[model samples]
Structure formats: structure tokens, C-alpha cells
Target: MFPENKKQLKLIYFNMKKIVAYILLVFIIPIASKAQNVSPLYKDSIQLQWVNEKYDSMTLEEKVGQLFIVAAYSNRDASHENDILKLIEQENIGGLIFMQDQAVHQIDLTNKYQTASKIPLLIGMDAEWGLAMRLKDVERFPWNMTLGALKNDELVYEVGKQIGVQANRMGVQFNFSPSVDVNVNPNNPIIGNRSFGSNPDRVAAKGIAYMNGMKAQNVLSSAKHFPGHGNTDQDSHKTLPLVPDNKADLEKYHVAPFKKMIDAGVQSIMVAHLNIPALEPDPKIPSTLSKRIITDYLKGELQFKGIIITDALNMDGVAKMYPPGDVDYRAFVAGNDILLFSQNVKVGKQKIIDAINKGEISEERLEESVKKILMAKYITGLNDLKFLDSKNIFEDLNSDVNKALTTTIFEKSSTIVKNDNKVLPIKKLKQKIAFVPLEQTDYDQFLTHLQKYTNVELVNVKNPSEINLLKDYDAIIVGAFLSNESVYKPYKLSDNSKAIINVLPQDKKTIFSLFTSPYGLKDLDLAKFDAVTVHYQNTKEAQVAAAQTIFGAIGVDATLPVEINANLKEGKGIATKHIKRLGFSAPENVGLGKKNF
Candidate 1:
């Protein structure tokens, strides 16, 4: 029996036949359903037939090429483009994962590369939150942790659908997103804000919701960092992260979301570079390179029939473990359908060809992976390849509709974790209030919004004289905007900021609104504040939402998705009422239909 939340239980009853098929797969039974039905992106038998036809017509070298999905960049020079062109023309690389660049540059390069390729290339990106994750000048959405705060999973689905829409517009086929890692470890360096939450069932529900949204737009979704990368303290990009959980623990926490995702029909699963000792006994061996983990466990035990991809091979997690050609070939032998971001495609391809020729890697195994790749290409409508229309690219990506849905998500996600003394909804607007901005960068947005409600004085907390002046105010509204750059960056308050916060009058009402990760609370003393609001990230929408929440312009409905300390447990939220005000609304909203909710 599969683990199901209340929502999922209702979903099971609604789609009983699909649930039955999933149950049968758990017992290793072959699904008789058509491939089109397996994933919503597939239209009919014609697509499946086309996949077979393509696979049958492919040469041995081309079949080998289908397994390698090399990395590309829109910000690179002609040399890089020429290299990629060579890979497409000679090596016949099947796909590409576009890295950081602008939408226009990426689209132009994608067109150029596709034109050079013999077969239509499968374009993919790591657009977890949105296109802004890997591109410049694109609309950015709230992080998964922010979305995790909302009670409604449907909003999270809209986030995915919008991301899919943007990806489709940019000529991307696969989106390596909806990271289903159950982030239980607060110290987890890589998958902190990227993950939905620490709860397995919640993560599973959110992952499925996101995948289905992408599927609606015919943009394939990839549930990533598989078997789980949630509990590690180390970054796989630098070195291998060892997950200490045993088999039973993994099944309960780590593998739960991946299982649910597979059942919901995810197109691909990106295997993390973590060294999971419970799944594979070999010490220092990345899970991406372990045949026992990828082939025997994932394919055999878990019964995952879709494409299995390795996380970027260029990452030191697996790269440091073996030579240039060895790791890529090992990944192929380990049952990965796509070798993503391989360090050396030339050597890797030759080694894989050698392995196949010598019967080390069987032809049947090679064919199976190649066929899956072709099926994915066909399902994504690559069979009818079309050039990406570059008209209104920037304006379309940053549309009013996208901003409206994003604002709604931020409004719902902004939470009040500790509102002691009922300092919030500062009804006494007549009282003296001072807004102290604490951040590395300028955060005038919060101050700007706060001034709209009341005559709030802006005080630079960096100065010692200003810290002394804060005591004169009836309430000190400390707006701390910590950076959410990468998990690798320190997200705690600076010494100067901490000193200012510590010096603030404990007796006076201090409304501390943190525009950062909730984990940022662990570094500061909670006793210092009269009230605390966790606004997840310092996005423009979050800044406005925090201010609105303070003045009772909007109600606080979100709860903490992750625990900061013992007193502030997960899902801890204090509700507040909204005051009568002229509220703003976008009538031309994109993904905010009542049917979705």
C-alpha cells in the first residue's frame, strides 16, 4: 500500500483505475495501458509508433548519442557554440541542458543548435522555481519553500504550469524541476529552499501537483535529486554528500516522494550525486555511478518505467570519483537514460561504444534507454519540430498575468510564526513607529509600503546613534532582508545587524519581519522580538506582503513549512484579521482560476 495524504486519498478515489495500475506496477506487473496514457503529454498511438520508427532507423553511434545530454550556455562565445555544433553534427548528441543566459540569447542559440543537429535535440533547463533560476531578465517565482507555506496545493500547481508555459515559449522540452526531496535537515547545503518541505506526504502531493501542471502544457517534468538529497549537510556540486539513513528510513522519508511521483506518471527522474550507503554499500561511490542503486533498486524494485537521468556529471560529487570517460560510461551501465553535463562527451561516447562492442554493456540495455529517449522526444512534440518565435520574448515572459499569480502566491505564503503580545495589525496607527532596514543590499520596498499605512520613519540600523534612537519609538519594525542566493551562502544576520537587534528595547513592541529563510531564525534570539513574521524571501511581492500584513491590509494564513526551533514547530502560524482598505486586484490573472483551487 502507498502512503497517501487526505488530498491524495481523494485523488485515488477520483482516479481509481490509475491507482490500480500504479498498485500493479509496485508488484512488477506490466502495464497494458498505451504509452500516451502513461504520460499526459503523449497524444496518441501515432507518437508511440513514430518513436519506434525513429529508434529502429537510428545507427549505433546515433543510439549512443541519444544517451548523452551535454550542457550548453546562452552567455557563451562562438567557440562554445561551435563545440556544441560539432557534438550535434558528429557525435550526434541527443539533448542539451541550457545554463544561465537571457531568454533571447538562449532562444537564438537553441535555434542555431537545432538547425545544426541531424535529429531534433531535446532542450531542457533546471527551471525549478522558474526560468530565472538559470536565466537573466526572466520572471522569477517564489521558491519551493515559500510555495510550501500555502495550504492549497493548487497554487503550487499553477506555479508549475506557468513555468512550463515559459519553458515552452523559450523552446525548452524538459524542465528538471519539482524537486521532491523531503528536506528534513535544516543544515542541508544544496536542497534547502529548493525542496517543497520536510514532510514526505506534503512533498509527494506538491510534486504530483507541479508535474500535472507541466503535463497540461505538453512540457515534460523531471522529479529530481532522486532517492533524495534532503538530509545531507554537504553540497554535491563540491563533494559527495553521504545520506546516513538506512533502507527502512529511506523508504519512509527519502523514497516516499519519488514513489508517489512515479505513480503520478513523471516523465523523468534526475538521480542525485549523493553517496547513499543504505542503497549501495560501496563507500565514496556516488549514487549516480552505482548500478546496484540505479538499476537493481530503482528500475527493478521500485518499478520506475520512465527515463532515469544522472544529475550533472560535471559536479565534483561524481566527477571526483572517477576519470573523465569512466564515470559517464558507468552511469550508462548503471541504467541512466541520459548522462547530463558529462565532463568529456568525446571520451564518454567512445567508452560507452567500446563497452557495448565488447558486450560489457549489453545491446538490449542500450536499446532500452535509447527507445525511452526517443519516446520522450516524440511525446514533447519534437516529431514536428518548429522554430522558436522570438517576438515579444521579454515582454511575454514578464507579463502582468505572471506578476499577478506570483503576488498571490507571495501573499498566501507570508506567515506570522510568533505574534506575542498581539503587536501585529498595529491598530494604533497614531503611535510612533520606526522602520529599520537590515540587509546587505537596499530594501526600501518594505519601508515604502509601511509609509503608505502610517508615518513610519526610516532609520539606518548600521549606525550606533540610530540604534540608540530606536528606543524612542512605540514599536521598532525591523525589516531584515537576508539573501537567498545559494544554499552555500551564509543566510544569517551580520554582526552589526545582530548587535542592532540585540540592543532594541525588549520591553517595547518590536515587530521583526524576516524577509529570508525561516532557518534564519535559528541564529537570532526569538525572545528579543514581541512579534515575528517569516516572509521567506526578499522578493518585491514578499516585501509588499510583509508590510500589508503589519498594517492589517492582508490576513496572515500561511504557516511555517519547516521548524526553526523547538518553540517554533512546523506549521506554526498565528492568524490576524485584515483591516478595511482599498485592495488591489488583477482582473486579467493567468493561473488564479477558482477551478484550480
Candidate 2:
């Protein structure tokens, strides 16, 4: 027993140390977990300590800087990067909102920006549908209108979770998304496809699911254009669109979803730059600058305890009405905790500082917002900073899982509003069908997929008299490929094309396939067609899904997200049971033994 045994003694010492460490971990892990579980808005003990300590250490200039979130672009040159760096170092700006960038470039820039800041920066993106909205080559999820068509709210939740996961992958803290503007106005220049649907209750339900899903991944969601931008005829980016509804109608149609989102504990609300005389008596004052709208109503009446953010200060909606720093000061005084995309950060910060010195804004008021910003950063896990490793990031962002989810979303969201005489799921594969594209556009994918089930002829036509050429086919499938370049672009058919469409069903069994926003349905006469199917976008996935639905490879479960006309109201969809005749598969299923596929 007295012999020296170095190896055995060392092993015994290591085991004892491990046992002690395990005992410590047992107590420490739960405490950390519990702290993390606490809502940042609630300001638990640990969060309060960090928020207060950070607030106390900051100077007035730094406190003022914390309220401004300037825009950043990875796609820009070195001069832009240097400017952003200057803001972080000199001005001590609060955060960044990256726009229109490449995936790898954005990630690398995020790390560089985060490393340069004295305090952790809160990175956000306008990724309403996903990063594809602002970043190139990322997985593009379905638009909110597409998601609104789904009967299952859980699917929409999964979409939000996936978007959040991708945002987190790129080291982003916030996503300005789930535009809960119940799009009741078809003439709305923006917020068409961005909104879930026209139904306020449905919009609120989907928005709540999406918000919760993002929260599950620690990403903050901001419900936008509050008090609603749904009923405006003009784009807020261009002018201060007047929301003309009375207070009761505004509450019923436009503001209902925002109220519901507030009730559901959404982390942020972006005040719109709209002139609503009903909510705010002053017709000249936009909601973003009105204390009655933001402070008294949203914060006081509705009791929204979360951070209030203003829409971009550079937009003409508010920018044209005020000078450079004036708009930011007004939004701040009105109750917005964060001023987004300020035209001049230097001037804005100076203006805010001036207000504080003149006693127009109390130091206590400034401290409240600054502390709230710090708490948000802590909640996003910025207290313990970790830079993103760019290895396989592009591939990881557009993984197989993302593609599969997208395919399922498109398939489930293919809606058929009318099927006169039940002409859908064309059972006779041997019938002579002509694929007529209404516009002078590409329909190769649609035509090819249609031919997968049966032989179809292509009819190229320019005039209304071309309807005569389609008389040879047993049935006619008309495909309208509308441009999705911008929401402001015209989605209606030309006069000549419209004439052909109206006359085609009178003589032939015409099936209309629309691949664009549902708002365009107002221009069309739905009652004239024998069958109508809507695939919301012109992507290849939508094209293939539209073909599958026509041939009965998939059934129709999606309903109209927005009301088109009096006849085609919201929730108008004809659910089709899947027929056994056709199934979707690889070409190999019939490739080997094919006798003309």
C-alpha cells in the first residue's frame, strides 16, 4: 500500500474532480435554463440586471444612438461598409437591417459588423416570406397569401419556424414579417400578396401562429403597418395613403388583426405612415407621428407592452412631410422605441439629444426606450456573442428539408374556385386538348407537365378570332401567365386576350388556369369559364402543381384567401377528392415501358 502508484492516483483524482463538476452543473444548468425561458418583455431578475447595468453605463449620445436602426447592405462597396463601421464606432448606432444581399456576403458582413460594435448589434431583415425577400439564392418560402389558402394553421406555423431558423442561421435577431393587414381593398398598391387574406379573424389567427413559431427560435417578429394598411388605394412607400374608414369600420376590418397580435404577445408593432382622420383627428398627421394613435390607443387602450417600431423614416409617406431629423424626433415622441432607416442618423441623434436638453423629452423617457432595446438584445442571446461560421452556410440555408416544405405548401395551396359541371380532373387521357396561353409568355413547364398525363396541342394566338382555331380540340385549357415583377404592375389580360377568353368557353369546354396574385381576379369573369384553378405565383413549382391539380394527381383543398367579387367571396373553394386515374412520380414510372408518354 505504501508503494508509489502515479497512474492509479491520477485516475482517482480525475474521477473526484468530475464528480464535483457534475454536482455544480446540476444546480447551474436549471438556473440558466430558467433565465433563458423568461420572456424578455417581462424583464426577469437577470434581464433587469443586465438592462439596467448597460443603461447606467451609457452616455446620452449613446442612449440616443440606441434608438436608431440604420440600413446596411452587404451588396454595397467598401465605402458603404466603412460608413456603417463609422456609425458603430463614432455614433454608436444601435443595430442594422440588411437588405438585398448575397447569402455568404451577408453572413460575413454580419460577423464583421458585430465584432466592431462596443455593444452587440441587433440584426434584422424584411424577410416577410423568407430571406429571399432581401437575400439572393436563399430558399424562397410561400408568400403570406399562399399560406393563407391553407386549411391548416399548423402548416403556416411551420413556415414561420423555418423562416426563423434560416434567419438565425444568418445571425439575424429580428424579422419584420407576417403583415397582418387584412387586405380588404383589391386596389391596394402594396400589401396584396404580403397579407394573409381579407378576413381579419383569419389573418389574426395565422399571424399569431407565425409569431409564436418565430418566437420558438428566439427571433423577434414585428407585425407591420399597424391600424392596418389593408384598405389603402395607394402605396405608403410613395404617399401617406389615407385610410378613410370610420373608427368602427377600422376596428372591424383593418385594426382587428393588429389588436389580436398584440393580445397574442407579438414582440413588436410597426406603425404605418398613413393619414387616418378617424384614429387621429389631425388629417395631416400620420399614425407613426400621432400620440393618440401610438401612445394613447395602441400602448394605452390596447395595452401593448412590447417594443413599438416606426416604419422606415425615409419613405415618402412621412419623409416628404418633414425634414431630415424632424421625422425621427416626432416618431420617438409619439412612442416608437426604434426608428428604422432614418434618413440622417447623425442629425436624428442630435435632434433627440437637443430634445432631452430642452426638457421636451425627459431623461427617464429616453432611458426607458434604451433599456428596452438592451433587453431585446439580451433576449436575442447577444449577451454571449458567437460569430457565424460560413462553412456550408449557403447549402444549409437551402437544405432538402426547406425544398420539401415548399413543395408541400404549393401543393396544399392550389385552389379551385369554380368547377362548372365538375369538369376538373379530366378523366379521359386520350381526349384532344389544346394548351392556349392567353398572353405572349412562356408556358413550357405547364404544357410539358400537362402532356405527362395526355397528349396536348399548343395553340399560339394573338387575336380574338383565334378562338376559331381551338374548335378542333376536344377540350381547351387556357393558361394565363401574369407578370409578378411588382405588385403595382397590371395583372389584367389585354382587350384582345379577354375577348378570346370570354368566347372560348361559350363554344369549348374551357378551363382557366391563373398564375398570379388573387387580387387580379377582379378583372376576370369567373362565371364564364367551365373550370377555374388558381396557383398564386408563376414559379416552376406552382406551374407543376397547377398541372397536377388539373389532372387529378392532387386534390384541391385550398380556398380563396381574399374576396374577388360578390360571387367569389373569401372561403370560396371547391374541394376535390383525388381520383385514382393519375399519380405524380418520376418519369421512370412510365419511362421504360412508355409507348408515347
Candidate 3:
């Protein structure tokens, strides 16, 4: 049961059914599993002795099936439900990870699947920041980039707590998130903004704090892209990334945060699709398939007893390296417990079946991985909290309290780095001012709120020349927003936007409002702009907060937790504005929070 966004969910269901059918025909070698005379609900730790004994009784076919965690869909048209049932009935596969779209109707689908298979599936998610981080029609919190700014680790825990609540309600047992990668490279297109921050200590602390909330909620969390994937410019989703660094570099900059996370009692670590010569010199193989790194380093050196899961098998990084079926075989040998997003479940099952028959992949190894996966299941309480009545998330998600915390973080963070304005508290609210929105839809709702305090003219500026409206107003307030989005990089006013802002009347006051991450300020050429106000998100709250700061309402204690440039030290966001409306009253709706509160 994917999102009622029926079109995409149905398509995913289609592929799932087809894949399940293939597994059924070849690998449905039914082997009856006698329930260990153990208690139905495992209260304490899953008795390792009983589990090992139970696993020993499983037939060869059942053991092999335990290694596969196939993707499935709910569309009855493809009818893969029976295929999954056959495996549970026969092979006893481990778990399933949902995609962005698979989140919809997840509860009912899981119920139906569990009823057919008679085995509880360890449901997983790429809830990197939260479940909504990837899914549509869901509430999306700010990226880790914004969280990195506030330096409030407790907030991360709150976020994790909320994530656990939402995900658990949807029957999710594991959350693959709190990317432990310390972002040292600004140019790192993929992990920069997703990381907590650049400092190893901070990244470690923030990651641990977030995990605190998750673990407290009993949500299984997996610290990911082992060794660290934050420095590479390559998107492994497209091509294999190389972490070409020496052991010292890895230990100092990259591995530090991960070590911190592992120490924090994390339940799992996801090996990246990286090729690092320091750990595994063979560029021919990815970390996901290299025993040298997976077993020798991750398992032997780090002593991570928890399950090791591979990133999505469909990713170009792994897909290009091995055929679909072989990826499963190699990943198992590499010590991974789960073969995520196994693109070819049918062929993959047979490969495992063959690997075991030929002794290429030992049955002992298969039992080890499967046992860990299942143990993880018992530990996560999935056996007890199976399927909750599905809630219509559209209304229940993103409550007002959550948005206020986001507002406090973002608004208090919009520091004024440089303002010659003594002109900022603009002396005259009676002055005509231009409201030039940076993006086509930049805080449109907040613009209406600006009318409450100011006697000003709001001008729509699509091109730089639109700054001509600057002639009519005494001061120019440029609501220029930027992000890590590919197109927005190397941000500049452009020919037309620049020409207009540059030619602004020198006699009049000018204030530049930067509503994206502050790192974007480097591209703005601070010399031309008289004042800079950075209200992190482009959310309506960001707009309202930024405008109020201009008029002096809220106290400004906001600062950057990370250094943006050589001149800007860590904790150096410019103190630009203060709150106008008084009191600590919460907003009616959090999703629209602003800096003005």
C-alpha cells in the first residue's frame, strides 16, 4: 500500500508483483519452520541460544531465503503478495525497505503481507532526516544544513522522537538516518547540506543526540555510508564514489563522527558504495562487496555486532559493478545482513541458492546474516507492534509546536553580518520600500503580513532590471534566496538582476535579505550589499521573521554554528534584526513559521 497517490504506488506495486512471481517459481522450495517453543512475544533480548537452535532446524532452502529482503507492491494487478508469501512460507526472507512513495497505506499493506506470510517483516525507511524527507504529501522538516546552524543537539533528539512516532505508527521498525558524515567539503554536492556540520566533534554530538531520541523511542537507527560519504562530489546514486584518502585522513576527518555514532549504541551501520584504497585498495569492488573492508574493517576492527545493510542495490554504484543477481551474493559475502532494494529478487534468490549449494557463500554465513536480521526484528518490537490503524497523515502531521521550534531556530539565526545601515532600523517606517522576491514563489504569504507594520510598496522582480522599481522606493529590500539545488549554485544576481541592484540609488538605504543557507552569501559579493539578513528557510516563517528583524521586534541571538568563509568564524552569523511582536506565544501553524515571531 503505497501513497494513495495511486499512480506511482500502483507502478511500484506492478514491479513488486512481477519480481515476487519470479521468486515464487524458482525459490519457493517450501521448508516448514517449526516455531521455537519459545514465548510468542520476546520480552527481553531474543534468546540467542533458542534462535540459533531454531535456525539450525531450518532446511537448506529456508536458510537461503532468509538472505533476501525483496521489495513488494500492493497492486493486486501484479499480484506479488503470494510470491512474498511463498518465500515466507518457504525461504523466510528478512525484511523490506520502503521508498518515498511506498509510505502511503503502508500499514494495511504490511498487515495483508504479514497475514499471508505468517512472518513479521522488518520494515525500513530512508527517513534520513524524517519520514517526510523523501515522501510527497508529507511534512518536511528543514534539512540537516539548517539544523547544523542552531547547534541545539536536543532539537535533533526531538526531531528523532517525532520521526520515531510517525514511522512507528506507519509500522516502520528501522530508520536509516542521522548521516554521521562530517561535511568538510563545501563543494560536496551530495552530503554537504545533509550532514549535521563540518566539525567532527559537533557532527558526532549532533548525530548521537538525534539517535538518543530515536533509540529512546525504540526505533532501530542505522548510521550510514560508513567511513563517511560527505566529502565526495560524486552522487553514488549515479556512479561509484571514491573516498581517495589515506587512513589518517579518514580517521581524523571522516571516520571520527562514525566512531562516535558507533559508540553511541547505534543498532546498525550502512556500508557506503564507496571505493577507498586506504581500506579496500581494489577499485574494482565497492565497499558493499569487499570482505577486506566489510569483514576485516567494519566487523573485525570496529566490532559492529549489529546488522550491516547495503545501500539500495538499484543505485548505479552497485548496479554498474555487478549483475543484479551477483550483487546479492557478493553483499552477503561482504557481511551485509540485508540486500536492500534488490532489483532482481528472483534471480538474486537463485544466486543465493546456488552460492549455498556450491559452498561459494557458506550456509553458516547465510544463517549469521539472517539471524542478525531477524534478531534486529525481535529487538525493534516489530513482532509486537505489527500494524496500527492507518492515520490520514495529511491532517495529523506537522503540528504547531513543531513549527515553533523550527521558527525559534531559524529566526534567532538570521544574524546581520554587515550593515552600514545605521539605516536598517530605517528611521522612517513612512518611507517607500521595494519588496523584490528572489524566487518566483519566495514567501508570497509572508508578503501580505508585511503590510501590517510598514507603509511600503511591494514590487515583483523576476529579472535584475526589475530593480527599476528601486527608483520609486527610498530603500530596496531584496528577498534573494538560494539553496544547494544544482541550478541555484554559483548564485549571483545574473546580468539583469545584478545590473539593476548595482545601479540602486546610492543616496538611499539598501538591505539584502538572504533567505537561504548563509554559505550563499559568499556569492553575493558583500561589498555591494549594505546589509545582509539570513533567515534560513524560504518557509513563510522565514519571510515574516526577516521582515520583523528589519523593524526591530525580536531579540537577535542567532549565529552560524559553522564557518561560512575565511572571514566568518564559526558562530558568526551577522546579528541583523530583532522581534517586533512580543511574547513567547506559539504560532497557529508551524509549517509557516517566520523569523519575526
Candidate 4:
């Protein structure tokens, strides 16, 4: 074996090594690759078996029915219930998204509908903040804008988990929440407070955290209103809103959060009724019905592999574009798995069947969405159909733990955006303080909380002439509480209120507490106030927190989540000293555990 010549020896050695390398490649690489792929498949084998079996068992009509998730109102009368029963019996609808009603009523209705259906129906809700978002007699969490103000995103996660827990207890399989839309446009009528904030990164981070928390509770989460509804001023419920950004701008801003959510394995996404010319060329066609937008951009480009749900079909946004049956058919063709809130489920079902018969909608396409729906049902454990326990549901939803968390959210979310002359902490008791109410409704709690610290005079400035009466007080505390019925309502101050604020003596210390949207301050001159605080909502907890912050009972550390104007930007907060009587406690003491739910 010893070579006589060096060149011949080297060539022989190289040939021998090449032969060994080929042997290893032929044998080892395939086995390694097979193992890597097989491992994931093994992990998913049970789910795959269940999905395949259930999908195979489904009749064509049943499979078609699975694609429709109609709207149910717990607050409706007997006629509505009978109508729903008819749809369930005739159309065999697969799911229902519960709308406004009492929690108890919803539970009863859900059980009734489930009994009527041949297959177990998946129940969902728009419980973004909590069950109280749609139903009465249920606990309400802080709005998304309020949650956005917190520095600790962990709290946001806990909020989501808690909401999910309530949703699960109420038998909601899916919670269409964590609206990942980045609210860059402050004037956005529909999505201002519903969205996390103006920053895409922050919105994405918060949305992922929330979705994960909900997922932990076995309640599927949906990142909503894609590609984005945050830039539109028109409410989609009434009309179609246009997202005027090009694809590049959308990817950077509007689509950023959605991309993050999809990458994080979000279970579902709600397609909005928006017109984006860059993505869909057809004029006046909604993104909900645009194949280019849904199939091409979201599914193809983004590679999203989950249930794609359309926003409520009853909304004028898509309803105006097509007739009743056509709307559902177009949305189905556009790649949406669930046709939500169809105006006429019977008609919609027939239309879809007709389309499928005509080869417009392929059997493969129908099976794809139907399989996803069945898979979701399996994932939610609906295959094992268990009725919700109606007893003590309200007590479970509105627990002491939830109340403590609500208080914590308000305390952390209330921001002291402007504090000139250091007028907070109300240290000098010698100065007589007058509490002026500039609210549509009575804000007795705010005044009552202030009165606990010192004897404060109440002045109702309904007219301009009442402004002069405030001059006697050494310091005037203006409490502006706005109605929190809907986000669409005008949050700005009235002209009379503005005039009253202007006539107030600038030299005198005037503390302005705004228990409304931060945008309400945009109309007023910030220089006129000695101190300015934003409560961000008119909730009683917020009122109490603002009052406590004023009297130095609680420290103010929350930063503005969104910009009000040029003078105030996001994250603008002024921390003030607490009085000697003030105290603090850990979140754990209030039952918000560090461990996951």
C-alpha cells in the first residue's frame, strides 16, 4: 500500500475519501432529514387524525354550513330566537358570534343553539376588553388604549388571560380580540381606542403577548381588521373605509403588527371591510372580498396558515357592495374561512352551494376551509361537547381578583401629562379648593374622593356667568368627565366650557383633571392650567384614580400612550411626589399572580 511516487499516492488518497463521503451522504443525510420532518408530524399526528376523520364524516351540506358563523343576540326577543332556530335547523350553521346581551341570556341561548345543531357549534365573541364588551352583567376590563399606557406588557398578558378565562367559563371558544391595528392616525373613528397605539412595534409586542395569554387559557385569539383599519376615519359598520397606503407603506406600518401575530402562530385573523387600491385593483370592492388581498397578499405572500374570518357581513362596508347572497359567496371565494354575521344565512348557504356546483368554488377549496373549521372545533375541545355551567357565572366573571386587576389597570394607566407650577399633591391646605364639574353626567365619585382629603366647594359651570364664582377659591380644580358610551362620540369640550376655562384667572392655581380621551386636551391651551392630568376614560375606577392622584394618595407615573398635539407626545408623563399618608402594594397582593394562567 505504500506509494512509490508522492503524486500517485495523493490521488489515490483523495479518491478513497470521496468514496467515503458519498457513502455517508447517501446513507446519513436522508435518515437525518426524515427524522427532523417526522418528529413534527408525530407531534401533530393526533390532530391530523381527528381533523381527517371529522372532515370525512361531514356531509356536503354540513361542511358548507361549517363555513358560516352567524350573529346571535342574547338581548333579542322570542321572534329572534325562533328565527335563529330556523336557521340552525334549515341551514345547519356551524357557529355563532354572540352579540349584545346579558351573560346569563347568552349562556342559555348558546345551549339552545348547540342542542339544535347536528354538529357541535363553535361559539365566539368580540370580547376584546372582556365579556362586558358586548354583554351586560359581566366584568369590564380597561379599554385597549388604557392598557396601552402601561410599561409592563406582562399586565397586558394577564388582562388577556383573565378575559379568556371569563370567555371560556361563558363557553366562548374564540375571542376575536387583540386588534393588532397600529393607530397611527389619531382621527381614526373606528379604531382609535380599540387599537393598541400608534407604534407598530409596540402594537405587535402587545398583541402577541395578549394572543399567547388567551391561547394559554384554551381560548383561541384573533388578530383583527387586517391589513389594517387604524388609518381609516369611516366606521366600517356604516360604510367602507379606505386604507390609502401603498403596499410598501402598509408593510411598514399597518401590516407590521399582523405579520408579527401570524409569525407567532395566531389561530385566526379578521379581514376588514376596507378598500386598498394598491392591493386590490377593483374599485369599490372591499378587501373582505378581494382575492388579491386575501389569497395573494395575506395567504400567499405572508404565508399565513390559519382560519381567515371576515368581519360581520351585516356591516354596510361590504353589504353595500353586493346583494345578500353574493356578499357571502364573494367572501368565501376570497379565501375567508368563516362568513360572519351574514344578513341571510339561508340565502348565503344556497349561493355558496350554487357557486360550488358551477365550479366557481372548487371542492378542494371548500374542503380546505371546512377542514380548518373542523380543526378549530377539535382544538377548542368542542368535539367533546360540554354545556356551560350557568350557575354562579356572574360571580365567577366579576370576582375580587378581576376588581383588583381593574383598579391596578386604572392606577397604572392614568397619566399626568402636564404639571406646571407643581400644582399636584395639593399640599397647602390653607388654599380653598373649588371643584368645578364640566361633565354631561354627574361625576360624584371624583368630587367625593377629593372631599375626603379636604372640604372642597362644588361649582356647576353650566353657563358662562357661573365662571366668576370660582374666583373666590385660592385653587380651582376643574373635573371634566365625558360619557364613555361609544368611541365615536365627540370627546372635546363644549364652547361654553372652553369659554369658562378661558375666563378663569391664569394667576390662580387651576388644576384640570380630564376624565376623557387625551385628545380632548387638543382644543385647550395647556399654558392656562397650573396642572393637567389625563384619566383616559370616564370609568369609576379611573375617576377614583385621578382623584387619588390629585390628593397625593397615589403616585402618578403613567405616560401618554398616544400624542395629543405638538406640546404632548407619546410617553409624556410627569411623576409627582406622594403625600406621607400614601401607601403602595405589590400586584401579587391583589391576586395577579406572576405565574401564567
Q: Summarize candidate 4's per-residue lDDT along 114-166 as a digit string, tens digits.
A: 99988788899998889888888776888888888877788888898998889
RMSD of 2: 6.1
Candidate 4 deviation (Cα RMSD): 8.0
* RMSD (CA, Å), each prediction: 8.4, 6.1, 13.7, 8.0
Which candidate should be chosen as best, given lDDT against the real structure? 2
The 0-to-1 C-alpha lDDT of every candidate, in the order given, reads 0.84, 0.85, 0.69, 0.83
- Model 2, 140-221: lDDT tens digits are 8888888899898988898889888898899999998879999988888888888899999889999999998898898999
Residue 532 in candidate 2, Cα distance off native in Å: 0.6
At residue 315, candidate 4 shows an lDDT of 92
Tens-digit lDDT track for model 1 on 359-461?
A: 8888999888887888888878788888987899988787766788888888888899888778888888898898888875657778888888889998777
Q: Per-residue lDDT tens digits of candidate 3, residues 343-454?
A: 6666778877887788787767877676776666676774464556756665445555556656665555556776684655454677787777664355664566555567
Worst 10 residues of 2 by lDDT: 586-595
